[model samples]
Target: MSLAERPDLMTTDPVTWDGGMGSVGDYIALLKPRVMSLVIFTAFVGMMLAPGSIHPVLAAVALLCIAIGAGASGALNMWYDADIDRVMSRTAKRPIPAGKITPSEALAFGMTLSVGSVVLLGLLVNWFAGAFLAFTIFFYAVVYTMWLKRSTPQNIVIGGAAGAFPPMIGWAAVTGGVSLESFILFLIIFMWTPPHFWALALFKSGDYRAAGIPMLPVVAGEDATRTQILLYSLVLVPIAVSPWFLGFAGVTYGIASAVLGAGFLGLALQVYRLRTGEAARKAAVRLFSYSILYLFLLFALLLGESLVTRMI
Candidate 1:
């Protein structure tokens, strides 16, 4: 049985500083910068696509607050999950588990940024955006990390709403309200997250199982997880393509979405079919990697069209 399955053997020692304070890099690593970058990009796309305009300075500030809020959520997650982090090979070297930063310090850092970001965004921009940003942080840090992550196989499904809110917050930053167009953007990410994360969980099932993460693959088995990945992918593609048909996007976006979406579906299908051995692992890895590119390109196309339309 996995260490996680043998809970009696699991260590609960208090995590403390090793010898000295962490370096700047170690501190930043606590923020999960890779994830933060994605949040910033997605939020920026939402801000850009909003119908109305925001002052350039306010727009930059909104993005900054959103980024900081996202980083804060990451830090909090690392803090709370440090116990599991130490057990999972993939996460073993995270700042907290590596003893580069104390859990209390990480918690303080995260909370400070979380409150500060929401307050600054509200005061400097619109409260609607600020409120949504606050909720996003709370959802990721509290709802997802603290609650759902360890407790349910449906964790990623329910927790994805947190990530989906960034675009809506960006839209509210400009228009001070959400419309169906903005919600569609939100829906695209929400639907895409399950398959994307599940693909990662497939190859990393061992890591998740060892850490007791209860990822779908760990709880439901690989075949079940693969089936769910394909189902989510099928639903995700059309929702991803909808912004184009809904008239918010143009033909260029429509064509790009359709083509990119075909590639996404093709990979998802491959993951579904390749059911065992190294081929299965490779397929899951490909889908995981492609999902990142697919989402980026889909949003990039929309951003490009928005900019070109503005220019013309």
Candidate 2:
């Protein structure tokens, strides 16, 4: 049966079919928890690196707000992008596209979570954080999902700012304002996004092409995308070291940043050098996988250095 004919399939409660069964977990999968985990981790790192300390309970509350906001963004994105998503292989099985969740329900869920997270953060934590969280929702759901994704080749470039906001929000939760330090954190993620996503685009061009999305690989072609990746990776190395130059981090972070930056550039260069379809795809996948590790390790090192300096 077509998706619209079986509205009952979208409900969260258990459904017994000719095949087997489904439950609440399907709806949770719709929220994109794996993506939320990364949001929480980066925000946590930002909070930790911020100048002041938040109480443990308050910190937990802040993190919860961030997670809820991230999930809200994801839900709304799914709601709006369902049509295109159904056409794309990578996204065809998502809850909305799979007919496991209705667009209206996802919209309601996202709206409720967005409002709840912002209000709770304002009441329990701080308004600056609340405001940032609210903006993040709007930027992702409206700016990126509704407008940018369908319109521009630079969609990921501009849309990346939405993902880059969590660290600043986390910093604001503790400090009640933005600062150069938080901005450096922001810049790091911003610069890192193009290379990371373009790597994925290189290997997944078919999915993007099917969705009619103008990703770098679709518009600029593989060779140009590879060149852009190399250029962006080169620029990122210096930006990654800016935390040390700006005095937000110590020499340890500077050293780690240099090493990580070199590793990232090396991968990008490999991707550029290996121009054959199979080799490029392998390099792209390797770079995509390593990029996640690279960001997490960069932040972890920063947090560790902060802790050690405090102890000393």
By lDDT, who's the top model here? 1
Most accurate candidate by TM-score: 1
TM-score of 2: 0.91
Off by over 4 Å in 2: 1-22
Quote each prediction's TM-score.
0.93, 0.91
lDDT for each candidate structure: 0.92, 0.89
- Model 1 agreement with the true structure over 158-219: per-residue lDDT tens digits: 99999888888989999999999989999999999999999999999989988888999888
Candidate 1: count of backbone clashes, pairs at least 3 residues apart or interchain? 0
Q: Enumerate residue pairs that collide in model 1.
A: none
Model 2 lDDT per residue over 184-270, tens place: 888888989999999999999999998899998999899999999999999888988998888878998899899989999999999
